[model samples]
Target: MNAVGVIVEYNPFHNGHAFHLHVAKEQANADIVIAAMSGNFLQRGEPALVSKWKRTEMALKAGADIVFELPYIFATQQADSFASGAVSILEAAGCNSLCFGSESGNIDSFYQTIGFLKNNNELFQQKVKYHIAQGNSYPRATALAFHDLTPNEDMLDLSKPNNILGYQYILSVQKQQASINVFTVSRKNADYHDAYFSSETIASATSIRKALFSENGDIFSVRQYMPETSYNSLLEYKEEYGHFHDWEQYFPLLKFRLVQTTPAQLKNIYEVEEGLENRLISTALESYTFKQFMEKLKTKRYTWTRLQRACVHILTNTTKNEMDRKVEKASYLRLLGMTTKGRVYLNKHKSQLSLPLISKLSLQQNEQIMLDIRASRIYALGTRKNQQRLLEMEFKQPPLILN
Candidate 1:
């Protein structure tokens, strides 16, 4: 009855993800796979191609036993914040180990990097700040700072996307002093950010998303790269919602928010800072599309991902104070979907679990969940269908139990 936890977005449950899930379960030698998945929005600050529920179904079909929603606040955050929140939830779910896909397949390298940085904490912090002051983005700043520390060849490469996230996952587990063992599996065929498909059976989620969007939702074009279950879910979602969710789909509303809200007010939103409001306002007024706006908005101080996340905060009207008040650790595990095996594991572990396991949104009353609620409303807003009907589903819908 042992369980292993994986931090995932499953933006579309493609072949690469299915591979990771299976390998993780096998490596951990666990009976159940618990996934801490991002909701409507992803870590890169983009809306998901499909809704969380649809993705949950894809996960269950792909082999995950239990799927938990990583709250919006954490889901749309940078790697460190994102990892910390997801790790906390998995630990709270009573996982015996954590498994992540990384460019550096060796788990020991992540431990080496974490321990090396922990011993050089002061210098590392100073270097990061110094880089930020020099107009580097947070990820860039961290990469520079990591280089400044001169980590050994045995250390994981913080420059790579998966490695950076994996490093943070292990670091988070250690910082929280959780008893979960950590493991890593090597990414195969395609890297995390690969934008072109080169492999026959494996492709990066980015490449799949790009292909799907560019092909105008021709699911068959990318069908070879994802499981049939994922392909079917995409078809179902397109039928019900009319189209897949993306930042381009949300741009008009986001532009409206940027134009209407005063710069002083934008400052209040989470992640908005340092006269960025003024810059964003100017960009919104001139640009008709998200792509045009992003082109004008890109700066060395902000990565494309960071800027998108800030834009997400703006669109959701999530304030700095609201995010600041909530503890970074998991106070609750919001169950999105599960298989019968998953339900059994939960029922057996319910009493021993440290956090409340929430299945229905209406039943859980916590301030931390408010951001998630707001995110869902915004996600529904992106759709062309009955907005109110979609919003209602957020509350009325129970966790998807895959039998």
Candidate 2:
């Protein structure tokens, strides 16, 4: 049961995702393709366009042999932790290779950058500090320092979203000293930040999401970039759950949580650093809308995404102490969905799995899983769909086993 692992957040399973899956299989030449996907909430610090279960079904229907939940704590962090968590799950699941999409599309280039960073650890750190002193954001400072130190154009490209995550995936693999072979498929069509659809067969998830949630959005316009199965599933989900969500919808909850909690208490939330708790506390009172609050809180030192993640943590009452206390590695591989082949592979390799394989949520009882449940409950609340907002949906829903 040789398998290739992919870390994904098919927020809405678009054609580009389907293409990535196909390429991963071809590149790894593996019998199975397993995806460790984000559940409910996403890395961008927002609720997913659809539920994790629907995304899993889309993936399984398209090509994935198995889909595992990447756990909430790991799924919504910065790239380094996110990659580490995903890699840990795949490694534990006995995946022999890891495949990802990258802007550069060159695996050797990523390795080259990794080698330079690893070899010049001290110099890189010094340069990063120097850049920070010069008022660059941490991500910007790191990228600039890497380029200044290595003079590799590709290394500089690590600033891009996909490349940054891809670089982190390689770093995570090296950090684990795992034997997973790495591969990359070049991203196609629209860029990561592109906000509109321009092609019939390819579109960025960002673009697709923007179209889905925009007030004037025509869902049919974005449907051309999704497979029939995915698009149809999305349509059904929309019919049942209303429309996809934006963080703004949860503004009241986020604002209420922030306003009620003191700065000292806000400081306890994960990712609340550099006196950000004070800023959040102050800004939360003055700003009436989520957009205004984000604007007031955002700083050059603290990225918008980082602030959003912090707000989500605050909203969910995810304390830094709790995350710090939880084991860094993924404790379990929670199954979201699977194909027939995936079931067979799981049965054959059950004993070989490094972590507990959880097909049912009830099988695992831990703080981390509880956090995931909390996230799902919050996501359910934001759905704005009367019948579909049940928290029990997370418990009652079983893995979508596709034939």
Candidate 3:
């Protein structure tokens, strides 16, 4: 009845993800696999290419026994909050371990790095501030600080996407003092940021997204790597909806929110701090697209992704205060999909669970959860078909079986 957990965006659920899921199960010897997945919006501050429900179906078909929605507040955050949110949810779901993919598959190195950061807080903080003042982005500033403290050029490279997130995961586990064992599978095939697909069976989510947006829109091109159910659903959805694309529809709303909020209020949004509010307000007024606005405001002190996430926080109304107040402990275990064995495990552990086990949508009537559900639907304001799909989504049951 033991379970292992994964935190993912599955942004399009490519071959690499399938490999990770398989490895997670094998490594943890888990009877069940649970995933905390991103909702409509992803951590990178962009709308998901596909819907969360569809992604959940893909995960279940690929190997996950259950999937829980990582709330928008946490999903759109930086590495730290993102990891904390996903790990907290998995822990609450009573998972015995967590498995993730990392560029540096060395867990010991990650632990050592975390230990160093913990012991050198004061010096590290001062160095970080000094780097920021020298006009480096937060990631760059962090990298510089690590180099200054550790005197190792290699450690600074940990700012690369997967390594940075991996560090956050280790830090979260350490903070929780949870007994959940941690394991990692080496990332394979394509690099995380590589936009090109390879001939092999495994590919990064970035490459898959690029292919999905390419002129052909051919699911068959990557069919060999994806679960049959996921590929079929994606093709069917694309055919009916002409591809769910872009986050432009929400731009006006975002602008309205930015313009309405005062400098002090903007400063409270995650990633928006230290006079960055003025830049946001000024740039938002002039720029047309979200990407363009972020590009215009990008400074040495803040990376593009960080600025993008801050904009998302503004659009979603997730302030620092609100994020801080969110219960760090897992409060509920939401069941998105599961197998028979997974169901049996849930039934057996239901009484022993620290949090309520959420299955039927009717059971989620709490104000905050309800608001998140509504926001997810609202975020799907892409196309008419998607809009209709969102409006009708409440009636759909969790997809427990592959088609």
Candidate 4:
């Protein structure tokens, strides 16, 4: 079977996601669609609004044939690493093509931008360093450097969040020399960070999430922005867990981690550096909530997302050494859910897969995947479910096999 891939978060699996999934398969003209969905956390350094299990169920019901968990290490990082891990998982799953939503839907533009960056890597790096030295954040610095090299709007815009990830997806494809051809579906109606509902049906995940939280998990407020399957999934998750996951939910635990660990010990957490330990600890102690703590911690040099990612590392006690030990590629394809088509594909290709296909959590013990287990445990604290039940959900539950 010809397979296509999508890298997704599906924080709540809104209509925009459903649209992307539908278009991706049509564009790729593949028999089955596979998704490398982020686990409990997301690339934006925020806890998922729901568990990965419900998100996987949403994906399968929406259009995805299979759902694979993008492990914690890659799922919560910035675009480049996130794209790398997603691409690796897709490749391992035997996808012949990849389709991603982007502001610039032109695939040629991505190749052009990547080729230009590669050719002028030295100059680009120098400019990035200069901008960073000038107090610009790393993401801002990279965008500035890209614009410095290409002053014209002739290439894909790296400043747009989806386009940036799309660019990184193409880069990861080239870097790994994978066999997957990539296509793009231009995002419609809303921007990546739009905080308000801009359309009747299409809304950004950010907007959906913001609305969900602002209304105190009232699924009806954002009902129009999601498919029925997704809408019901949101309802089901809320009914079971009593609350959606978010940074604020885990603030107490984060504060506990912050207050107990010394600055020296805090420095060991990934993304904690440049005396960020002192800032995090001091600010965490003074501020009562995650929002207040982040507000106090924000600086010109560090983005909100960057600080949250650092906090995620701290909350998980993920050390820099732990991440540094992870190799460039994903070691296993952690199946979360699948339809009948996906099962057939997997059964046929199981013997030829590049990475191990792990469905049952009981039989696997890779060190990198230990982070995923640890992350799920940490994620449970953000919800109202019994911690033991959630942990057991991680270990005892089998992959959701949809018919």
**Best by TM-score, which number?**
4
Which consecutive 10 residues in model 3 have the weakest lDDT in total? Answer: 150-159
- TM-score-based ranking: 4, 1, 2, 3
Q: Give lDDT tens digits, candidate 2, residues 85-149.
A: 99999999999999999888988888888777779999999999999998787888988887787
Model 4, C-alpha of 225: deviation from truth (Å):
0.8
- lDDT, candidate 4, 312-382, per-residue tens: 89999999988873456798999999999999999999998999898888535887789999999889887
Q: What's the lDDT for residue 383 in model 2? A: 71
TM-score for candidate 4: 0.98
Number of residue pairs clashing in candidate 4, backbone atoms closer than 3 angstroms, sequence gap of 3 or more or interchain: 0
Residues 196-284 of candidate 3 have per-residue lDDT tens digits of 87756777777777776678867777777677777887887777666665556667878888898899888887667889899889998
Task: Give the lowest summed-lDDT range of ten residues in model 2.
Answer: 150-159
TM-scores for all candidates: the values are 0.97, 0.96, 0.89, 0.98
Give me the runs in candidate 1 sitting further than 4 Å from their true place: 215-217
Alpha carbon lDDT at 132, candidate 1: 94
Score candidate 4 by lDDT: 0.89
Clashing pairs in 2: none
Better of 2 and 4 by lDDT: 4
